[model samples]
Target: MKFQLDEPQGGNTIHRHDTRSVWVNGTEHRNSLLVPWQGTVEDWRLTRFEDLTEAHFERIRALKPELVIFGSGSRIRFARPQLYRALIEARIGMETMDIGAACRTYNVLASEGRAVLAALLIED
Candidate 1:
């Protein structure tokens, strides 16, 4: 499925997404990546939900987002709270969903000027 959103004036907004890839600001990303509401897009090393770890969540914590939208590949799978204890302890909110939903939600939140991050996991 593909998603479309009215482009935000600045910052990153997820423009489109399908099962195989997510397009951010008109650029397609097939690998796991970090899409901050207002920052550089970078490749995330995690490839699957199982690859998630405290270290990974710590990275998200370092980004200092008010909330995080975790795109767990093609389905909705909640991560163990311990895996993201850092974010929890920091009081950073997080929501888990399928990749497609995450993309849509990210776009909405970003367009509304929320400090959100989309940590998307793409199956290899």
Candidate 2:
């Protein structure tokens, strides 16, 4: 779906998203991604939920966003806390949702200038 905001966004904006792909800054990203508040979008590498590991969470933790929106693919799935122990220890908050919902939430928070990151998983 397409998204719109009244005012201009100073950071990266999620323009559209579906089950397979997400459009950010007019670029199509079919792979999982790390969409930060502002900066070049980074590829998250994992394709399926099972491919996720603690290293993935650590990658997001290293970014230091105040909150993380984890798009756990087409469905909502929670990662075991141990997988994200680094984030918890750092006091970074995270929320999990389906890819579509996560995309929408990320855009809203990003538009509002929140220090957020969208860790989207694209399933094959």
Candidate 3:
């Protein structure tokens, strides 16, 4: 799906998002990735939802985002709290949603200048 931004400044804009890809700043990304409010996008070398571990959340925590919008691929599935114990310990909140919702939410929060990260999974 494509998104039109009302306020396009202050952070990265998610122009389009789908099951296998997302367009960030007009460039298409076809992999799981970490989208920060105003920083370089990082590729997340992950394939399966079941493979998520505390280490993944810890990586996000290291970036120091106040919150995370975790996209569980094509569906909305919650990871066990144990899998993200690092975020909890760091006081960094995470919200789980389907990939599409996560993309939209990330754009909104990012435009508002909130410290947010979208850990979107583009799984096969």
Candidate 4:
């Protein structure tokens, strides 16, 4: 799949410190976009949502994020009920949206200072 990183507003860096708006594949996204962050995809944990396991859930849990966004690729199906239950048991807010929307939501929430993570299952 073709992947492009749309810069946040002002074309600032989309780093840990810099906060800005962005568009992932024509979809508008703020820092508040929902996402299932797997500890910097560039450096570690590069895997699809379907490949995640309870151990992965434990890692995300350690982040203590307020919400966990699960990007089920471009479609909102194939949610791992087992993982969902684990998250629910931890009392973490969870949202399952399309990858595009997930990117947008992750940015929006992150900008708002809400703890959020995104798992973008970009299946090309």
Candidate 4 to truth, TM: 0.59
Give the best candidate by lDDT.
2
Q: lDDT for every model?
A: 0.90, 0.91, 0.90, 0.54
- The worst-scoring run of ten residues by lDDT in candidate 1 lies at 1-10
Q: Per-residue lDDT of 4-119 in model 1, one digit per residue for the tens?
A: 54666678988788777888988999899999999899888887777788999999999999999999988999999999999999999999999999998998899888999999
Q: What is the C-alpha RMSD of each candidate to the true structure, in Å?
A: 4.0, 3.4, 3.6, 9.9
Which residue pairs show collisions in model 3?
none
- Compared with the true structure, model 3 gives a TM-score of 0.91
- Using lDDT as the yardstick, the better of models 1 and 4 is 1
Query: What lDDT score is found at residue 33 in candidate 4?
Result: 32
Return the clash pairs for model 2, or none.
none
Candidate 3 error regions (>4 Å):
1-10
Task: Write the number of the candidate with greater TM-score, choosing between 2 and 4.
Answer: 2
Looking at candidate 3, the ten consecutive residues that score lowest on lDDT are 1-10
CA displacement after TM-score superposition, residue 36 of candidate 3 (Å) = 0.5
